[model samples]
Target: MSGLRLEPVTFAQACAFVDEQHRHHRAPRGHKFSIGAAQGERLVGVAIVGRPVARHYDTGRALEVTRVATDGTRNACSTLLSAAWRAGRALGYERMITYTRSDEDGASLRAAGWEPVAVRPPRRGWSCPSRPRAGGEVEQVGRTLWQAPGSAQAPS
Candidate 1:
């Protein structure tokens, strides 16, 4: 992980990486911005941050780390996560959040100073009677929301 460094990434690039490497979720439709973890010239991971998916947390000052995908690189995930909150705080966002499935441990989140805020119940899917939708690969699993604590250094 010594050679790993954060680099500015385009939305398309981040989405592509997630599509190719993520374990479950697909690339998000959009983002406020994207950050990448690179080891020398190869991009090892990406983090996409944008408005919260839950309408309730979509306050103007809130941002969510919608997708984080890594190519099994050591420390890549935690590094990107820490950078995300730094970027969020530098932009004046009051809150930053992300989630991990109930079965997944949040070691990276803990390493980045994020704390668990909720244990969300499992959902059948995103499809509902009111608005039609297709739940992607992994939707039925319950998840835990993790929120970044206080402020941090500016964008990393």
Candidate 2:
């Protein structure tokens, strides 16, 4: 990951990068803003931040890291997480949160100074007769919620 640089990137560019490089190979439905990591001229990773998907977390001061995709570059995920928190704080957000699947190690989030707060149970896929959904692997898995250091705890 030589010459690694972090900079703001548009949603479209970040989505494309993530779709191409992420192991999950899925782009988020939307994002408020994104940060990109570049090794020299090549974009290697991106973190997409936006309002929390859960309505309970829709407080004005909260933001969530919706997706983090990296090209296996060392420290790229940590760099993006740290930068995303800084960017949130700069924009007057009081907290930043993210989730990792239960089976996935959160080493990158921990390295970025985020703390695990809770383990969310697996959710049944959102498939109603009216609004069918294409379930993915993530939906069947539990997740661990993590919050950036110094952020307030989420409301119960």
Candidate 3:
């Protein structure tokens, strides 16, 4: 498997890679994923999959793919996400869900067998940053409340 390179990304690494992906794709935070694509030592693309957001549909045990993007000429989102799906399945996730702007080139996602399940209406509200103190350090951490739709308070 040396020829195939896909791996889990740290939160900081995911932030950086997602920033690069969003720079081109304009993906929103709710669609955040945690995988990176690389060719040898060079980074190429990223794919993110997590639970559905409160503003979106519920994907129970269904991973919601937030964004996928490539750098330069290397198109690696498919490979990365395929690996992620396999990993997700291994971890007991049953399905994957995703949303893309109608104008975005999401053919790779379609080709990878993700079909549109719901369309998000245009957003209109201002969102605030959520930062809390941890061990006396200010940290930007996701609130584990029932944030996602159809979610209950579960221990993290």
Candidates arranged by lDDT, highest first: 1, 2, 3
Worst 10 residues of 1 by lDDT: 147-156
Give the C-alpha miss distance for residue 5 in model 1, angstroms.
0.6
lDDT of 1 by residue, 32-86 (tens): 9999999989999999999999877887888999999999999999999999998
Off by over 4 Å in 1: 127-138, 151-156
Write down the TM-score of every candidate. Answer: 0.89, 0.89, 0.63
* Whole-model lDDT values for every prediction: 0.89, 0.88, 0.56
User: Of models 1 and 3, which has the larger lDDT?
Assistant: 1
Q: Superposing all C-alpha atoms, what RMSD in Å does each candidate have to the true structure? A: 4.5, 2.8, 9.1
Among all windows of 10 consecutive residues in model 3, the one with the lowest summed lDDT is 142-151
- Residue 128, candidate 3: Cα error in Å is 16
Taking the candidates one at a time, how many backbone clashes does each contain? 0, 0, 3
